[model samples]
Target: KGISADVINIHTIKPLDAEAIIKSVKKTGCVVTAEEHNFLGGLGESVARTLAENNPAPQEFVATQDTFGESGTPEQLFEKYGLNSEAILKAAEKVIKRK
Candidate 1:
């Protein structure tokens, strides 16, 4: 659990900061993308493509799988869908191992 990670806040998905992503990957040698959206065509996919083209590295995604949504409090929903900090830490650990 003594791993250091770079957190890039990608505000705009359309204009994804590919350069920043690549830079972080170059330094960390791995990546974990955490998003509230579905895992398929979201930030994870975009970052994956960016890494595949620029610098390939082990990656993990902490996003909700493609499934029907359920109504709940934001905390409950995040916990259920693995969109919480614990999930992100687990993903980071997994990806670091791959490196």
Candidate 2:
């Protein structure tokens, strides 16, 4: 996509791709991390911490908060928790401003 030059996806959590993430942040000066897990211990948090320690880039987290999901369709849960693409875009905009 012309909107983004490169996209890197990681699979592991414990040993996150800190170096690659930092490299991307160094180039973009901002980041938006999306994950299906809770924000507290999710990949977004780890990325935020890494950026804070290395270069301190602004980061948006698109993940569930410290809350549990209810017994409903996945779409229902996503809408209820504001976890859709619109929400992520809004968060990314906000984070970019903060940067």
Write candidate 2's Cα lDDT for 4-56 as tens digits. 42366868878898989988888877888877678897888788888889989
In the range 12-32, model 1's lDDT, one tens digit per residue, is: 888999999999999999999
lDDT by candidate, in order shown = 0.93, 0.79
Model 2, residue 15: displacement in angstroms? 1.7
Q: What are the clash counts of all predictions, listed in order?
A: 0, 0
Question: Residue 17 deviation, candidate 2, in Å?
Answer: 0.8
Q: Could you tell me which residue pairs clash in candidate 1? A: none
Best by TM-score: 1
